[model samples]
Structures are given as structure tokens and as C-alpha cells.
Target chain A: MTSTDTTTAGKETSKPTPQMEGTTKEFYDFCQKKELRFQCCSNCKQWRHVPRLMCAECGSWEWQWLRSSGRGKVFTWTVVERPMHPDFVEDVPYAPVVIELEEGVRMVSWLSNCDPHEITRGMPVEVEFDAVSEQLTLPKFKRRNNPL
Target chain B: MSALQNEACIVGIGQTPFLRGTDDDCSSSLRVELQACEAAIKDAGLSNKDIDGILPFYGLSIAEDLAVNLGVRDLAYQATSHVGGAGPGASVANAANAVVAGLANYVIIPGGWYGYSGRRVRQIVVQDVNAMSGGKTARDFYFPFGLTAPVQWFSFIARLHMMEFGTKPEHLGAVAVAQRKHAQLNPNALLRDKPLDMAGYLASPMISDPYRMFDCSLEADGGCAFVVTTKERARDLAQTPINILGIAQGQPFPADDILTREDPFHLGVTDAAPRAFGMAGIEAKDVDFAEIYDPFTFQVIQQLEEIGFCERGSGGDFVADGGIELGGKLPVNTHGGLLSEAHVLGMNHYIEAVQQLRGNAGERQVKDAEIGIVTGFGDFGDGAIAVLGR
Candidate 1:
């Protein structure tokens, strides 16, 4: 609910959708249901992203979807200006951040609450869901205070 | 250990004019490839009948298609190198391997694209896609969130490099300015007439933070090709043979995921350099010039450091005070590179090295160029390097 809508950035260009096929369906479905989840290995307990059937660390096929605590810190970021695609032309000057989650996994998302100039490496952030389309919802991040 | 060492030599080099923007009725990518391939065949004093083997980089020209077009009675070998921009140098190595194995006598490595004019018709030379990550990669998680394009991914790396090495944006500008200076001397360079100073580079609008317009390479419509054969055959050809001293290819761990690389600044050159240098029986200091694949300015700095030309993280200092210019320690990208020349992948880099070694490079040729090297950087951090000498 805390994710701010950025549709005004570009109208003709629709918000990009994740590939909703194969092992990634569950991940996208969870986003639409307002839940932040990632895949974890059943054997070595390693967290991974992009929804894979096998674990990168342990070669374990027995894995399960686990809900993230919705917390992480910024590992790095880029403020995109004059995006390459015409679909993203209106969304110029948006900051896409790569976050290292508390569960020891990393993924890319956009910063929600903070100004682009104020963004820095290793800043604490928490997840928010922005429902761009009826069937598509994206996980974004916002600056966070002390967490439980 | 050195299976292909000095087994092959680059005898001839050819290219189409690196046009910044071509007319709408210009040749297609395949045609450009054919043109360059034919030109290279002629340059080598060989005809269609002599070309029994074909090794292409980045899928530029299909060997079967070229064979049919050239009306060759038989085609002995055909091969290709993978990795985006890093394929050309490796393709050279692949050609040498084929030659030593007695598969083919003459191998041609050809590459080209309609980078500029194609964009007018919505045909971008380099599309930011998720294919490099395979069917399932970190890109699927990131793309929906508006994290797209190679520039954005590199911006992330630039930030990390800045944090780790205190590298400044000016260091990147230094690369742009120096390459443009090199371009001014080469008539074939696309940006030869256009001037680029450090102030202009800094004043240009930022495409992605840490990358200005000049920081990226020129997307032009051009084609380039090279001819390789045995040293004995090359001595009798149209030009002096540039000996293939060494070649090697390497990749970073989790090569598909740029975000999860073991170290953000560390790249495939960490492994490729040592193997290539070892095979060449030389060290970094022995190289008189280098044509490192530089799609972006910062990559020149990174590759130089990783290739052991300078200490790790000393790229920022190595590029200062005209050190990379002609008559300096290592004159890199003397043909203006992708930044000022044309983005024909890194095939043009190979051609530049060939020209310098043959002692035929008109104005921009390095003085007494004895040994030189060319490196290619590819998608998601894979790399290839080749060392050549006269």
C-alpha cells in the first residue's frame, strides 16, 4: 500500500511485465497478492531470485517459496535518464536500486520514498508493492527506520 | 600446452566505411558482412576457392551463406565464438586452433552491423533484452521494476567502482577525450571531424548517472573482417603477417548475473589476461600497444588494470597525464575504438592491431610496433584476449 504510483511518467508506454510463465508464475502471483517472496533451497538454506527450480549453491531441486521480511539495504543503484525504450520515455530520471535483503539474497527494484539525489549505497530500505496493471504488480523499496 | 601458438597469422584486413548514418536504401547486415568478407578475401590475394574455413564472431556472417554467395565448390570448416562483444578476439584463437588441427588452411573472421541507420526504422543495434540471462535470470526480477539496458547495469558497476577506488567521472572523460584525439588522426573514424573535449564530455546530458553521452560508443553502420592463415602462407600474401602469439577466453562466476558478481569491479580479464600472456610467453610490459574492447570509457581503465598493465585499482592513475596517448606507455585504441570509430563489435580492434603490426597504418600507426594485444569484453562479464606480434 505504501508504493506510490508512477504511471504519469509515460502513458503510451505500459509498465513492463515479468515473464509470468514456468517457475516465475508463483513469484508474480505473490506480487499481485501484495506479498514479497523469494525461492530458498531446502538443503543449504540459500536464498535466490528470478524463481529457479534448482539451487545455485547446493544443486537442490527440493525448494520452497518463502516470504521475505520485506527489508533490505541498498547495495547499488542507477538513476535512469532518457531511457532507451520509447515505452519508458516518460519515466525518465527514475532510480532503480539493487538491494541486498536481510535473508542474504539480492535483487533489483526501484526506490519509492527517497529523492534520487539522496540515494546512497548500503542505505536501509523496506519493500512496497505497486500494482501497475490489473495483472501486474512490482516490488519497490522505500527508506526504512528501525525495524522489528 | 601452447597448442595453437604461432600457428596462424593475420594476413589481410578489410572493412566498409564506418558510416555514422547510412541512407535508407543501404545494404542489409548480411550484405555488409559479405562486402567486408569479399574485401578481406581480395586483400589476402585469395579467392573464393581458397577459403575452406570460416570462423565468425558475434554471428556476423553465416559461413554457409557466404560460401553460397561466393560460389565456393566446397567449404571445409565453419565455426563461431559466443559472448556479445568478446567474440572477435576469441574467434581469432578459434581460427588458429582450426589451422593447427589441419581442419582448414585459410579462415576468415567477419563481423558487421547497420547500427545507426537501422535505428531509424526501429532496428537498434544493441537491444537491452533478458536473453543473456537465459530463460530464467535476475533480469526477470529486475526488468519489471524499470531496471533495464546495459547502461543501467554498468551504472551500477560505475557506482561500485567509485565507492571502491574513489574513481572520478573525470577519469571516464579522460578516456573519451583521448580516444577522440586518436580519432582525429584516423580518416576512417566516424567521429574524426567532430571534436570532443573534456568539458564537452562533462557537459553532455547524462544518459544514466555516471555515464554521459560521450561515455558510450558511437552506434554506426559499418562492417570489418580479417583473414588468417599459416605464417608460411602469410609471408607470400598481400601484406606482412601479424603473428598470433597467444589467445585465451575467460568468464566471471555466475556469468549470467551481473548484480551478483563476486566482486563488482573484478571482471573476466582477471583470468583471461594470465592465460593469454602465458601462452604468448610475454608479460604486460612487453606489449607496445593494445586495442582493448572499449564500448564505454570506464572499461578501458578497468581492462587495463585487470590485464596487469597497471596495479589493480590504479587505472585511474594510469590514464592520467597523456599516458595512454601515442608515445606513452601503452597507446590503446589508436584507431579510435568503438567510442570514436564505429561499433562493429570488436572486429575493428583486431583490424587496428593488424594495421599497426603490418606497418601500413597511415597517420595513426604506432612507431616501431613490435608487439600488441587486443581484448574483447562480452555480455554479463565474459572476456577474451589475444596477443599478437610482428
Candidate 2:
């Protein structure tokens, strides 16, 4: 059955806001602009996440912050049957899926707008943003309705 | 054989009482660490002046203070590994290297913490717990999306393993039941008297999907330390010397990004265990028992398979039917492990191996257990394993 809560749905605020500073600030600003972007190595053209200053492959300090296609497949996932943060109590039994983005990069985000039971390995999904706070907007995913 | 093989041995094992709650008397983390080191030194029958090298996996690099206070003049080697929980085994590996290289004679690897007492246990709150503690970039990205706590990180593995290999929740429950049985025999185990069954594990409150309360490790305050010296020297000391037959450390490619791994089911130990067995001049079959680091039940299942003890995707079946129990094919974590005994960052695994090899393990002893293996996993896919024998 589809999860009943829509706390993380829509363009609205959620429980706790993430603190943004440094490289994290740069990443969140793009989300505030409603653009999902991550680092791409200019030298090796390798996609990386948790944004790093240097490429592990080419050891190049050169990089570009490229916008994502906002599309990926679920590599693996876990439904948070018990919320770890009190702020997340309303969102109990939420699924945090690690999506393999089309650009060959992976990122952690919530899987929304579908039944938690419907989530499965290699399931196609697309990104949608929720402005959880004034300075913070989190990217979440829902099942892709149509193929690209 | 490698020059490091049989060159160094564990001379003593020491630890403070493991506690489920904070100790009013030993309140500070430093005090617990110091007392553990003191106990180790006392057990070794050596003065502080005798420790020439120190490997500290925890604390604020207090080895210098310990060396000076022990009234030591020359400190030849001092080092630490960045991998937190995965450190103890590698630390012992480093100590063995230092001893064999003549960089130091007596190397001590010390670890302990006041997790329960210090109120550092994971709570239902999303705060700066990640960035402030380790300050890694991964935390900044993952923590914001509610992927907090070690339990969540591990649940990712459990779910994937289930999806790929058809591993059931009962497969994971088997590990918890077997380890609790071992804990019952260990009077030092925090959950010693507590009993668990598959039905109880399945019904236990879910902390994270695919992980119930019994699947997770306990938050306990305790400390454990061990002394590493030359095998030749350890023979003259207080107890039977547990020789360091082989040791190795490994990391998955791009080690930190668990999501980016080529195979989600494999961890650092996949690469580490083979080299350790090779260096020990033995195979996985030669291991009489194992002291696997189990912060979660699924971890033990994964490690048992990945360590070459069984084929991949078969750890579930391997651990079934008491396969890892006291009389099973492999009697693992004979001292209850982090799952039920205490989480001393896997140092307790080493301590138990030393005890078993020395014939000092009373009720939980594996018969004729001459060779054993201990593994550590932490820092997002980094793993280490060491093989010890009498």
C-alpha cells in the first residue's frame, strides 16, 4: 500500500532544516534555484557525489557543477519503520533510496509519491524538490511515469 | 612465510567492566581508556616504561601522555588509523609491523569508550551529529535526507542482500540468536542473561526496516587493550603467547561512498581476508573459530560469506542450523561480540581471540582452538582482518 504521509510531499517545509555552509552551501543554493546539480570531473568526465575538490580518477583539481537529468533507478533502499529523529515522526515508515543517477553518479534521497511496498531494485524514478526551510530544499524521488 | 608471521604475539589482554549505563565513578572517556591501558599493562606484567610503541584507535592521541607518565624515555613508534571501528585489527597489524621492524619492542593498541555513560547513544533527533563528529562530506549529503545513524547505513546492505540473494529476515535473525547464546555463557556480556529467539527478533520493534532492536548492537561503556611483543619474548611472560600469523587491511574501490561500490553486497573484508589467510600460510578452512565484528546481525552474515568461509549469497545458509554456534563449523564471537557483549570498537574481538588461544576461555571455549580470525569494519566500507594462532 502507498505510504499515507505527505509531509515530505509538495513544495513545502519539513521537520528539521539542514544547516548549509561551505561547499554544502553551494550545493543547496542550486536546489533553492530548483536545479539538481553535482560535480563532474572535466579531465576524466567522471561523475562524483558528496562533492569533492579533486577527482580520484585523474587527480585533477578541475571540475564542473553540471545539472542532473533528475532521473535514475533505485540501486537499493530501506524503509525507516522507526524514525530516528523526532522531526521525522510524522514521516514514519519512509523509504530512503540510494538512486543511481543516469549520469553514473549515486545520491541518497527520499522515495515519495508511491507505495513503499512498490519500491524495488532498479526501479525507474525522477527527482522533485521540496523547500524544507528558508535556506534548505531537499531533493526527493517518485516513480517515473513515462520513459525518456 | 612472511617475516612478520609468527614474529609478534599478544602478551596480555585487559578491559574494564562493560556497562549498559554510564558509570558514576569512571565518568570520563579518557578515564576509561586510561584504566583499560593500565589493566593491560598490569596483565602483561610489565611497567609503563616497557611500552615503546602505541597505537590508539580512539581518544585524542593520549599515547604520548601515557608514554611519559609510564616514565618511558624513548618512544620509537606511535601511530593511529583513521578508520574508527575498523581500526583495532589494523592497529594490531601495525603494532606487529613495528615490533618486527625493530621500530619498537612492546606495542600496545588501546580502545574503549563511554558510549552509554556519555549519552552519545543515537537519539531520535537529526542534529549536527555527523558533520561535527567526523566532518566528512558524505555526512553533509546523506544526513540531510534522514539517512542518519549506523543502523540506517547497515539496513541499506541488508535490504540489498535480501533483494539479490533472497536472504530472509530469519537468515539475519539466526546470527542474533547464535550470538546471544554465546553471550549467555559470557558473564562479562551486558546481555548475558537475556535470551532471544527468531519470533522475538521478528517481533522486536523495528529501529530501521530490515533491522529490529535485537539486530543492532548495544550502547555500552567499556574499554579493552592488548600488548604485542616478539613471540620469543612473549614466551617468557605471564600467559601463553597468541602469535600473529597473518594480518591484512583492505578497502572497496572508492572506499567511502557505499552507494558507489561495484558490488553492494561485498565489503572491505572481501579483499582483506584472502591476503590474511595467505600470509598466515593457511586457508579459510584452517580457521578453527572466528571473532567477526558484528555491530549488526546482517554484518556477521555478510562477513562470513565474504571472508571465504562460504560462497557468496550463502552466508544466510552458512549461519543457519547453528553453523556459527559454539559447536558449529565455526564458533564465532565466542565472547558475545559487539552484538551482545560490548562494542569496544572490535578490540574485544581481539581480546577474545587471545583468550581462546591461551586456553583461558572457560565456559565458551572452542575446543582445540589453535587458530582464529578477527575482523573489523568501519569508515564506510573499510575493513581489516588478522589471523592469530598459538
Candidate 3:
């Protein structure tokens, strides 16, 4: 019950986040070229994070690239001051957010461009990227605001 | 054989050196257990070659692993019981049944792993012939919600238990202090003389919402072996033979099929207590002392409530009386426990129960103890309750 928001900036971060190594030959090719893509299920016509072998709803194996808007909201999160990974030591007080996308999927992504004290459970968010290594870009999220 | 009662006894016990590290895979610890078996046989005043049966447990432990390590020239009967934490009790009951059935004159039970050897458990997976991976029922349904490890799995239960009853973290913290205090007196204990305090408990890192680093058991390398033989053989071989008066077990319903299984009160302990009570012809009050497993603080409360020791959800208050301490009415874990003592798959718990009845617990001895009960519960709702008497 002591779970609290740590991030304070609440800034809107704009950009398409990076994907972990190409999921498939074609997807990898797309990522290598810095193109955003996801499996658009032909049957359900939906995009999914954590690329799966088949469609969860229709059980359809058919899918194709469907570029996403890369926007979501914080469904839940934890502010971790301790880093389990030695690489993450510099990122202390980081908020690991479980974001629910407008497309109806949840992902655990790092929330940056904000202080840990400003984060909360249902905050509007958008994706961004942080360079982790020469060949890797970490997908991070930040508080997104809706424009009327 | 008597539907619930049997004249069974733990004739011998064995243990390995409590080390922080070790060589060899899981098999190395199994070999240590074999050496323990050799020693225990001599302690029981029996020949090591007299073992005729074997019962092991699941997890990092494998019976065949022990057989290969013990180099069993021949195995008359052998079986492995489930209920990860339930191993010591369930296996003991199974071995006792084997003895009563006249299927085995002497049975050997061993369970030990590289618990603290810094070996990665998940990475040590065996080749799955079924290639089966993933959860089942409720867990499978909730796998998407980030509940994987036992820490996370118990987190939900701990939260609800707290919400329902006014259980404080200190009440749980008391469990560590009590057990650690006992360890201070035991020469073999890893944390001897390094007991914890309230400030220390508060300073420990939180593993989950309610559980701190101290709440969990150590996953280390050690071996626990037991020799089960006929009561007649025990009398002829050993000076003090502890009698096994009763045994019982319980299992969880399928995770998906049932949400509320016979109320929270009718949980696993309900399944274990009755059969044991019937077998021993004794009530909860009859237990001179207890060696209840302490893998988690809440599980102990769960057992106390379920065993009818106290009213439902009154576990925290029941234990707050210091009843589990050395001089308390029912002193628990005189040899420390998996919490403060080393975790030898609760085999050490079994050994302590025998020691209590035999009046062999030197400094931690319970005064004039005659009858005792030891429980083992964990791993997929498996449980074993054994009543031992002098």
C-alpha cells in the first residue's frame, strides 16, 4: 500500500521506442533500417508487443507489419532505487512502468524525462528511445498529454 | 495400516557440513547425503549395508541422483514424493507405510541440494521429455500479470492476509528473531551469535510487499538423510528410539477449477490435521512441542489457524505469546529452523522432532517432553503432519 509515484517532471516524451533484436528476418531488416513495425494480425488486424507466434484471440498465425502510433498510459509501476543489473546502477530511482497502450497491450518499459516522484498509476504516456549500446536502443516512456 | 495410526519411528538421521559453497552439481550434495547415511547408520548402531528401501523428493533432489551417488548396489523399493517442502513429512510417511506393509525392513530417505552453492537453479533444468513449459490454471491465467517467482506468488497472499487481519510486519519479524535466537545457542548454526533485532529487521531489504530478505529460506548446499527401520530393529540397534504415532497429508485443488476451496480455514492444514489427530488419538493441545516448518512467516500462521490451534485469522496473536520460543508451552525449532538455521529441505526439522522426544536436544531441550508434532508444507499445496512420541 506504500506504493507511490517517484517521477516529478511529468513531461511529454515524443518518439518511437526501439525494439529488441529483430523478431523475424523481415522485422530485423526493418529495425536495422530504423523503421518501426509490428505484426498486424490479418484475422484480428491488431499489433502486439512481445511478438508472439500466433494471435492470442483468433489463434491466427497470419500477420504483417503495421506501424504503430507508439502511445500509451501507465497501468501500474514500481519505483526501484536498487538496480539488480550492474548496468542499471546509474539509473537509480528509475520507474519501471507497466503501460497499457491505446491498442490494448501492456509493456514494462522504463519511464524517463521525469523524476520518480511524479509517476502514478494511470498517467498518460508516450514512447521514447535511449541509446544503450552501439547496436541497441532502449525503449523508454514518459508522461504524454492529450491535445484537444 | 490402521487407517491413520502406525507404530513407526525414525531410527537414524544424517546431515552434511553447513558450507557456504561446494563443488559438484546436485549430485555432489547427494553424495554428501550418502556419507551422512553411512554415519547415521553407525549412530543408530546398525550396519550401513542394511538399507533396503528409498524415498526421495522433488525439486533439485532426485532419488536416482542419490542412488547413483550412494552407489546403491541394489534398491529393493524406491519412490519420490511431490510437495516440494512436503518432502520430509510425505517421504517419511511413505517410508513408514513401506515398513508397516512389510515391503521393507530398512528404508533410506535422502534430500539435499547445492542450496547455497551459488548454483543457478532455473539454469540447472533437466531435459524435459514432455517439453512442457509454462503455468497451469490460475497461474497460467495470471502469467501475463507478472507473477512468476514464489516471492511474487506469495505477495498476493501476504497482502490479503494483512488486509483481512491486523497483522504487522513486526509480528512476522518476531519469527526471525525467535528462530535466530535459537540458532545463537546451536554450535552448527550458520548465524550463531549473530541474532537480529527490530532495527535489523527494519533495515533488511524488502523482497516483496510484505516479506523482507529475512522472510525467505536459504537456498544452499547441504544433505539430509534418514534411516527408517522397524521399531523392533530400532530398539535392538539404538538406545533411544522415538516413536512415530501418526501421519497425514493434504493437497491443493487445481488452480483454475476452484477459487475458494472450502473457505480459507479449510485450506491445506485442515487436510493434514484431522488424519494426524485420528492417527495419534491426540488433540492439538497434546503436542508437547512443535517443529512446524517456517519457509514463510504467514504459512506458520496459516497452519496454526488451519490446525485448530486458534480461531481463524488469530494466528498472529496466538504466536505473539512467545509460544514458539524455547521455554514457551510448545517450543518450536529448538535447532533453529529453515528461517534462522540452514535449510536442508526441512530434514533438519524432522531430526529436531526426534531429538526433542528422545531428550537429546542439549541446551534447547524442552522439559519432560513426551509427544511432539512436526509439519512440512509447501510446493503445490502438499503437506505432511507427523506425531512422534517418547
TM-score of chain A of each: 0.86, 0.85, 0.72
- Winner by lDDT between candidate 3 and candidate 2: 2
| C-alpha RMSD over true interface residues, each candidate | 5.3, 5.9, 10.8
Please report, as a residue range, the 10-residue window in candidate 2 chain B with the lowest summed lDDT. Answer: B124-133
Order the candidates by lDDT, highest first — what do you get?
2, 1, 3
When 1 and 3 are scored with lDDT, the better candidate is 1
What C-alpha lDDT does candidate 2 achieve relative to the native structure?
0.81
On residues B151-244, what C-alpha lDDT tens digit does candidate 3 reach at each position?
A: 4344435545665787778777777777787888777677786879867986888765567778766565677777886687777876477777
lDDT of 2 by residue, A26-106 (tens): 888999898999999999998888777899889999988899999999988888888776556777778778999999888
Query: Against the true structure, whose DockQ is highest?
Result: 1
Deviating ranges (above 4 Å) for candidate 3: A1-148, B1-4, B23-28, B68-71, B118-145, B255-266
lDDT of 2 by residue, B1-390 (tens): 788877899998899899977635544456666778888888988877788898877443367766765566888898888766778988988999998888999988888777776645354113334312243544466666777667887899988889889999899899999999999999899999989888988989888888998999887888888899998778778877888999999887766667777688777899999889989999999999999999899999899999999999998999988999999999988998999898877889998998899888899999999999999987676789999999
- How far does residue B388 in candidate 1 sit from its true spot (Å)? 0.7
Give me the displacement of residue B278 in model 1, in angstroms: 0.7
lDDT of 3: 0.64
> Which portions of model 2 miss their true places by more than 4 Å?
A1-23, A115-117, B25-27, B59-61, B68-74, B121-135
User: What is candidate 3's fraction of native contacts?
Assistant: 0.00
**CAPRI verdict (incorrect, acceptable, medium, high) for model 3:** incorrect
Q: Per-candidate TM vs. native? A: 0.93, 0.92, 0.71
**TM-score of each candidate's B chain against the true B chain:** 0.95, 0.95, 0.90
